[model samples]
Target: MEREQLIVKVCGMRDAANIESVAKLGVDMIGLIFCRTSPRYVSMVDSLAGFMPNYTVNQLKEMKNPSKSTDIKVAPKRVGVFIDEMPQTIITHVYNYRLDYVQLHGYENRIMIENLRRTIEPDIRRNVKFIKTLHVSTLEDVEEYKDYEGAVDMFLFDTSCRLGGGSGQKFNWDLLKQYSGETPFLLSGGIGPEDVDNIKNFNHPRFIGVDLNSRFEIKPALKNIDLLQEFIQSLRK
Candidate 1:
């Protein structure tokens, strides 16, 4: 049976080759993590886990500013992921990467979101979308952020854990039925290629998209492109 179109976002990306491969698939969004705590953090200097030399500032600049010989085919909109970062710092990365959307995966309250909205440059702000993350474990978790409907463009629902995200965990999607907020949301957490059937069966008016992460990874920060391609194809089928 045909299904409603859903936005596909492959987050926690680091490798340049992998990024290019994923981009060519024409996924809706490609996420690059900026939070240091997460294994998927994009950095210039090599880190302890050796995920660095990964997605440095200069590399992102080069990707956005393509050269004559190096024709980068960026099909998906780049989404920058942040966790409790200062407003100015987040703004800097947004401008640096020419990010199309900023996913706040931290404990940023309404005030912080408001500050970010006000502080970001007008031109960038106009085009860039703000996706606020609501870590959910219960119905109350979804209710707490109701006041942020106007502050953000979309809401991302992920499983709550000690670590920010990329926990490779799935929340009780049933709890989302209790969400009566006006804004649409993307379902995340432990989503993998196999879950396509579950996603197809899941029904929700505000279900606009799905955020794929750890479950699709080859290792921490590196994605299994083939698996992702299959999942995307299945979603469209």
Candidate 2:
């Protein structure tokens, strides 16, 4: 197997302390859940227990064009994870928060993905990349998403959970190795600190990243940064 850039993405981050730890670690991306139906939803006034100073979108925006050297450090490219949200609603957050990526985890068809892309094309400020996800129960499910290969910038194959993503249970890795597509994808599902060796052993050209969710969580919305740090460090080794 040839060595490739292994991207580590820490997902479902709720508060600031974990976010800062992840940012400082220089992971590729961090996901903030927007789906209210999911147990991992991070709402307004969510506790800042572990964070240095709490901030909202408007507050962060004011510091964006910092006049003082003490302006708050812009955190990792904020990624909003949505499932079945109205395109307009997604647009609102994307523009308001200056999001870097919109990860669609619902049953959004190819048309929806394209429409979302076209919706923000005229407005540079709202331009955000789309990452479509597919739930994998079998190798056939992986094959089913080929038509969408070119429609999305990246594909996230997560476990088939009752409520959709955030399930820490992993699917079959051998099935993923059989995937014959050109679209680069992230392997998600029940991935934990122990999965590092398994991932390193698996060989595939299109394997781009790993999505960590429940396995790295202390609770629904909180994360254990040490688990993530160990996992990431192991990848580097």
Candidate 3:
């Protein structure tokens, strides 16, 4: 497949400068974590375990806008990561952040996913995509989510850990060879600069993209733009 055909998503971004820098690199999607327990959570906090600071919806809006100093146009879709949040809360945040996609990183049932899709306004619903995260330790784990093929727009394969994600650990990619379901998936979990060669060797017709997070971060929610740029360039080459 051509380099442009592969979608690239940089997840767990919070710092505005870093967000814009990555966006300028032409990533296909930017993920902002909404799960409170995650170190990369984007809401009302400046540092790890700090007091809840007030954040206005405008912060999200600002990130989407172009920088005044440059004409760099960032066209990446904004994705919000949530963990078992209520349908209403998801819907509210979707609009508030102007998210183009919602990544469900919790153990939500089919009913909950359907309810979320049905509840969002038709206008927004038509454009928004839903991604269901599957924590994989075995091939059976991938098959178990087959029922959600129709409910979610895509599947994210992440390492199974005590916490939902940001485990900074990788799953067995060979396990995905057993996935027979037609749903396309984004390969995530501990993907960093060093994985470019392994990623290039990974061949699966249904593998549509890759999501990078913890491994590329200078700290939680702060990505190393230089490393990310090199990774992106390597992928293109």
Candidate 1's TM-score reads 0.86
lDDT of each: 0.83, 0.78, 0.82
lDDT by residue (136-167, candidate 1, tens digit) is 99888999767688889899999999987889
TM-score of each: 0.86, 0.85, 0.87
- In order of lDDT, best first, we have 1, 3, 2
Locate the minimum summed-lDDT window of 10 residues in model 3.
49-58
lDDT for position 192 in model 2: 87
True lDDT of residue 63, candidate 3: 64
Residue-level lDDT of model 3, residues 1-237, one tens digit each, is: 354467899998887767767877878998989888888877754434332222233345456753533323556788989998888888887876778899999899888888788877485555788999999988888887776988999999999999888888999999999888788899998898999889988988889889999888888888898999999989877
Report how far off residue 130 is in candidate 3 (Å). Answer: 0.3
Question: For each predicted model, how many residue pairs clash, with residues at least 3 apart or on different chains?
Answer: 0, 2, 0
Worst 10 residues of 2 by lDDT: 47-56
Q: What is the lDDT of residue 190 in candidate 1?
A: 88
| RMSD after Cα superposition, model 2 | 4.4
